[model samples]
Target: MTMSLGPYASFIVTSYAAAAIVVAILIGWVVLDYRNQARRLRELDRSGVTRRSGRSAVDTP
Candidate 1:
C-alpha cells in the first residue's frame, strides 16, 4: 500500500521535524540541570549543610 502527503508535504514534514528537535533539546536541558543540581547538593552536604528535615543532602533515604 502507498500513501500521499498531498501538496503540503514539505510543510508537514518540517513541522514534525521542528517539534522533534525541540523535544530533544528540552530533554537534554533537563538531564544536564539534574546532574548539576545533584552535584551542588553534594557540595552543600560535604560542607555540613543539612535539609530542614535534618537529613543530609546525599542521604539515600
Candidate 2:
C-alpha cells in the first residue's frame, strides 16, 4: 500500500533511509574486524609461538 507523500516528504524519507543504511554498514564492518582480530590473537597465543627470532614484542608492535 504505497500512498503519495506530501511534497518534500518523499525526499526526507529517502535521505533518512540512505543515512541509516550507511551507518549500519559501517557499524557491521567495524564489529567484524574487531572479532577477526581477537580470534587471530587467541589462535597465536594457543599455538605456543613465543618470541620472534632476534625480534622483541616491542619491535613487532
Candidate 3:
C-alpha cells in the first residue's frame, strides 16, 4: 500500500520535531536543576549552612 500526505505534511513533521525537541530540552533542564539542587541541599545539611552575614561573592561599590 502506498501512503500519501494530502497537504502540509512536511510542515506537520517539522512542527512535531520542533515540539519534541523543546520538550526534551525542558526535561533535561529540569532534571539537571533537580540534581544540582539535591546536591546543594546535601552539602548544606552536612555543613549546617547558616544565615550569617558576610561579604557577598562579588565586591559591589
Candidate 4:
C-alpha cells in the first residue's frame, strides 16, 4: 500500500520536518540548561553560598 500527499506535498512535508527539528532542538537546550543550573546551585550550596529572599532583608525602624 502507498500513501500520497497530492500537489504541494513537498512544501508541506518540508515545513513539518523543519518545525519538528526546531522543537527538538529547543527541548534539548532547555533540558541541558536545567541540569547545568542545578549542578551549579548544588556546588554553591556546598561551599556555604546562600540564596537570599526579598523578605529576608532587615527592616529599619
> What overall lDDT goes with each candidate model?
0.94, 0.89, 0.86, 0.89
Which candidate's TM-score is highest? 1
lDDT of 2: 0.89
Clashing pairs in 2: none
Q: Please, what are the lDDT tens digits per residue for candidate 1 over residues 1-61?
A: 8779999999999999999999999999999999999999999999998787766679755
Which scores better on TM-score, 1 or 4?
1
Instruction: Give me the candidate number with maximum lDDT.
Output: 1
The residue-by-residue lDDT of candidate 2 on 4-56, one tens digit each, is: 77798989899999999999999999999999998997898799766477697
lDDT of 4 at 37: 99
lDDT of 4 by residue, 16-61 (tens): 9999999999999999999999999999999998766534457433
The candidate, 1 or 2, that scores higher on lDDT is 1
TM-score order of candidates, top first: 1, 4, 3, 2
- Ten residues in a row with the worst lDDT in model 2? 48-57
True-structure RMSD, every candidate: 5.8, 6.4, 6.9, 2.9
Candidate 3 colliding pairs: none
TM-scores for candidates 1 onward, in order: 0.82, 0.64, 0.71, 0.80
Residue 59, model 3: Cα distance from true site in angstroms: 35
> How many residue pairs of model 1 clash at the backbone?
0
Kindly report the root-mean-square deviation of model 2 from the true structure over all alpha carbons. Answer: 6.4
Q: What TM-score would you give candidate 1 relative to the actual structure?
A: 0.82
